[model samples]
Target: MNRRIRSIFWLMTICIIAINAFQGYWLWKTYQINRQQFASTVQSALFQSLEDQQVGDAKRLFIRKQKADSSSRMVIHRFDSMGSRHVRVFVNNRSDSISRIRIESEQPKRIVVTYDTQKRTTGANPLPADSIAKRISSLVLLDWTDRKRVNLAKLKAAYRSELIRRDIDATFQLDTLTSKPQNSLGNFVFYRNGDQLTTDDIIQTSPVPINPIQNLFVQATFAAPELYLLRQMGWLLGGSLLLLILTTGCFLFMLSTIMRQKKLSEVKSDFINNMTHELKTPIATVTAAVEALQNFGALNDPQRTQTYLAISQTNLQRLSDLVEKVLNLAVEEKRELVLHPEPVHLADVTNELITNHRLKATKPVIFDTSISQDAIVVVDRVHFGNALNNLIDNAIKYSRDKVTIQLSFRGNIDNWQLTVSDNGLGVPKAYQSAIFDRFFRVPTGNLHPVKGFGLGLAYVRQVVERHGGTITVQSEPGKGSEFTVHLIRRD
Candidate 1:
């Protein structure tokens, strides 16, 4: 089309592409950040839960180490040897004394037992040393095992609850595999099922191996973390999606506008070419006719001069009509089509156009008009007659030999229907819809037989619309075509 419009269109295209690309990039970055943040929050809560488990494990180990009864510690007064059946235990409570001592061991682990001198002198004879050692050792090991089970169950439950509170819903199995505790601050590191746990092997207790604490593992995993992040960013993601939709809509609208503008420019260009051809033909004919009258001394014979003069006048009138149609179209495009509505007879108007057509035809073409009644309509006489003439002229011009046209008036007094039918080479089904579009002519491939600048039906449709009427066509291929104009009859 035009250079300036083309430039603006290209600039808009680039802007749409660039903005979309930028938004895409921004969305990608936001996704990554959200994922990273979700991971960070999850890990932080996971490690904190692991630390809590470690503290619980430590507390269990301490409870196992102290075999004192709940009432008081089982302390030794003077016995302080690590030999068989003898051990020193601290008395943590001064006001009370231990009534019983519980010891637990699996196998091959030694157990030493001791008691206060006062309890030995209470008249209850002590059991045989070996039997006492074996029984207390087994009970201690049983108690420790039971407490271990309880503490482990609590730890697992706490771990799950902690994660849930942080919004991480994971399913896990307690890793049955076990290893000696690291005996250091790193004893609480968390591991998934398949992951590794690094440990340093320094001996923990200096005196004896009391509670052989080992690290237990709870391995967990959840579904997609990104999906979780998407849920978390509910309104944010929705707003972003809405923004994308709006952006896409704007892009499509701009593209559609540019394409329509380009199409209009092409149509206008064709109109200019066709207009130049139509105006030149009439002007050339008139010029030739006038030149002949001036140069050939045709005035010497009255009939010859009159014939040349008529030819000149006819061509000049045709030329003037073409120019006037163009000017009227321009004015209508600017929304300046003026109407001088007045009372007029529809039948008279139809008859006048038919009689004009008969007088203008070179070879005899059958033209007829039937007026049902002299119905009156309020319309601009000049433009309304011109609209009717255009429809009739197009019918004749596009027809084959033996051109027969009929004009008829129908309908009641309130509204009148004027139909013009012609036995022309009828319009194709494909081209009928677009016949009234400005500069849209039916394709006459290679022959160019039909003349006129494709403005006749368009002008007729516009003039009728300005007078508050409607026009339509009914036609079929190879059959005759009929144009019907409906206008309100004015009193």
Candidate 2:
């Protein structure tokens, strides 16, 4: 059984470890995937943010040019009754050859013009116009070479907005850089900006061109990307951890229960063997004494007959006591052991038990007693006496040639204590805690020279607890053992 249990324990241990390892591998893969998705999302947002900034700048420039050119331009609009319109304009100013003209009315239209040095212009496809004229928007004179620093404040705002739009709530550091990074694309790259942002410190970095015409790009560096990822997968991580804890707890609980049951089975088997030996001795003795009286005609001699009868009665009594102890334990367990409590004098009981032990014990013994005569404690008299008797019986059975017993009963303000100490073969420290457990003996194996079914201490504990009391043992191997029973004082 022990070997089987050990095998099961090792197997379960390996299973638990494998489960943890697999879970750890799975989580790592998941983290990597989430990281990749995050980087991709950030890159997309950066590109979209650049486009948004460019559109805004271009619209502002166009609006400013239109307002400036509106005063010097010729306005033409032809509308039918159905609000359908065609616009045609000829600019009289011969500033530059017609380059680009954007016309905006109820609907936006672009009419690009081609011209000659004669200060005359014609549309690519004209609408019945005889002569040609030049029309140029104010944008034609502006220099494209003056590339100012990209609007960092505006870019940051747009970048953050785009990230939020994509469901990412992470903080970042943004800067415009003209020099391209020399590092490979997928690996972590360092961007040092006084804060010393290293590759390890950075979560992700996305570089996007500031504008279409410039070589400059905006770089966004995110710190602690893992924190964000953890928050995103909070529920999944939490649930997995909880399940792992519960699984380990259940495994430990099951293992402990198995071990406890195994111990119980061994103890019960020992109890059964001990009970059989105990029963056989008394039965054999009685049978022999009866046989002597019936077959050997011991009845013819009154003295011999009386001796046989006495021997038979004594053995019968031993058998009856053995059966009674077993039955009482069973009845107590089945019915939850109710106690009928009454006031009992502690001193009188102890004195009577001491006298009985002195008269009945076969070995040479010494009794030392300290009992409070005035101490009257509430307890079930019969059960309490039986409990004490079991303790005395055990002390004598377990001792060497000469046994010295100490019986002490004292009453405190809160409780009454009865202590039984003896110079017996004291129990080892390791087995003290288990001594009160049913069918648990200090010595292991099938047969023990000491009598009793290992029910004495168990019955004592049950009786004491049922009376709202407690029992404790203090023992040192070879020195001796002291058993104390504490009963609560009731007014």
Please provide, for model 1 over 159-260, each residue's C-alpha lDDT reduced to its tens digit, 9 standing for 90 to 100.
Answer: 578768977664443333334445686443333344544333111111122233333333333445556666777777788778878987987887788878
Can you list the residue pairs that collide in candidate 2?
Answer: none
Worst 10 residues of 2 by lDDT: 77-86
Off by over 4 Å in 1: 1-29, 47-228, 231-258, 336-352, 358-389, 403-423, 428-433, 443-448, 463-477, 480-491
The positional error of residue 271 in candidate 2, measured at the CA in angstroms, is 1.2
Model 2, 286-392: lDDT tens per residue? 99998998999898999999998899899999999989878877887788766788778877887888889889888988888887677787778898888988998
Per-residue lDDT, model 1, residue 343, is: 78
**Against the unseen true structure, what C-alpha lDDT does each candidate score?**
0.64, 0.72
| Stretch of 10 with least lDDT, candidate 1 | 201-210
* CA displacement after TM-score superposition, residue 296 of candidate 1 (Å): 2.2
